[model samples]
Target chain A: TQLLEQSPQFLSIQEGENLTVYCNSSSVFSSLQWYRQEPGEGPVLLVTVVTGGEVKKLKRLTFQFGDARKDSSLHITAAQTGDTGLYLCAGARSGNTPLVFGKGTRLSVIA
Target chain B: EPEVTQTPSHQVTQMGQEVILRCVPISNHLYFYWYRQILGQKVEFLVSFYNNEISEKSEIFDDQFSVERPDGSNFTLKIRSTKLEDSAMYFCASRRGFGLVMNTEAFFGQGTRLTVV
Candidate 1:
């Protein structure tokens, strides 16, 4: 089975602090997506990375896909209270395949 | 913007009872999927539907689970016999089309919280 392993299952940081979460897998993926989920809500798409070694930035959040397409990372610069949520990473083996999701990193940003 | 929507934000049912979760995918989306996340666990893919039939399904989607797109827009998931362990949050997602170049990003619904007693 293809598995995505995420590190630092829980993180709590003060406002203005920076944090980085990782998602790694042994199998290569065609595309990788990042999502943020609030309590009692479904995951909302943050970004999708399709090319290897690709980097995309959204405001204070930066996402990067590994050169081998088997790993990815989400870095939040100067996190705010609004950044607190369950961050998840999911990978698709192909265009038509189902996504394999990581366990996710739950972050709490305190002001 | 258009988005996926699910009905009955929360559902509670007794063990062995049947429950049907409903979802309405984005208007133009062609690929639909069902996923479940147990409390404090990772989101797990259950099934994928396309062309009025199931395109793929995971082992977890056993005989007890079934999916249907009765109408052009509504997608549904029925759990024939719910068990105590079946309690979880179920999410429905849909994408525009399939291809390496086409946009493959999926839009998700708010999800339905199922509690099997």
Candidate 2:
């Protein structure tokens, strides 16, 4: 079975701090996606990277896909309390299969 | 932006009972899926539906779980026999197409919290 593992299970930081969350997997994926989820809600897709070595930026958040498509990272610059939430990484294969998720990194920012 | 909507934000059922979760995917989406997340755990895929049939399913999707797109707009997940282990957040998502390249992402619903007693 393919599994995506995310590091730094929990991260607590003061406002304006920078944080980077990593997601790794031994299996190769055709595409990788990053999502943000709040408590009691389903995850919302933040970005999707289909090409190797692709970098996408969404305001203060930047997501990068590994050249080998086996790992990805999310970086948040000058993070604010509003940015606090559980960040999930999902890998997608070909066909109609559902995406697989990582355990996620729960981030909490204190103002 | 269109998003998936699920009914009954929360549900509580006795063991061995039946529970059905309902979802309304995006109007133009063609592929639907059901996923579950135990408390503080990774999201696990259950089933994926396309062209009025189950195109893919995971090992977690056994005889107890069934999905149907009964009509033009609604997708339903029926748990024939609820178990204690079935208590979790069930999320419904839909994609515009069958593959990631053409459609890209799945829009998820808010999720229904199911508690089995």
Instruction: Give the C-alpha miss distance for residue B101 in model 1, angstroms.
Output: 5.9
The alpha-carbon RMSD values of the candidates against the true structure, listed in the order shown, are: 1.0, 1.2
Instruction: Give all candidates' CA lDDT scores.
Output: 0.95, 0.92
C-alpha positional error of residue B48 in candidate 2 after TM-score superposition, expressed in Å: 0.4
How big is the positional error of residue A25 in model 2, measured in Å on the Cα after superposition?
Answer: 1.0
Put down candidate 2 lDDT per residue, B12-78, tens digits, no spaces.
9999999999999999999899999999889999999988999899898999999999988999999
Q: Would you list the clashing residue pairs of candidate 1?
A: none
* Model 1, runs deviating above 4 Å: B100-102
lDDT measured at residue A100 in model 2 versus the true structure, 0 to 100: 93
Report the lDDT tens digits of candidate 2 across residue range A18-62.
999999999888888899999999999899888889999999999
lDDT of 1 at A57: 100
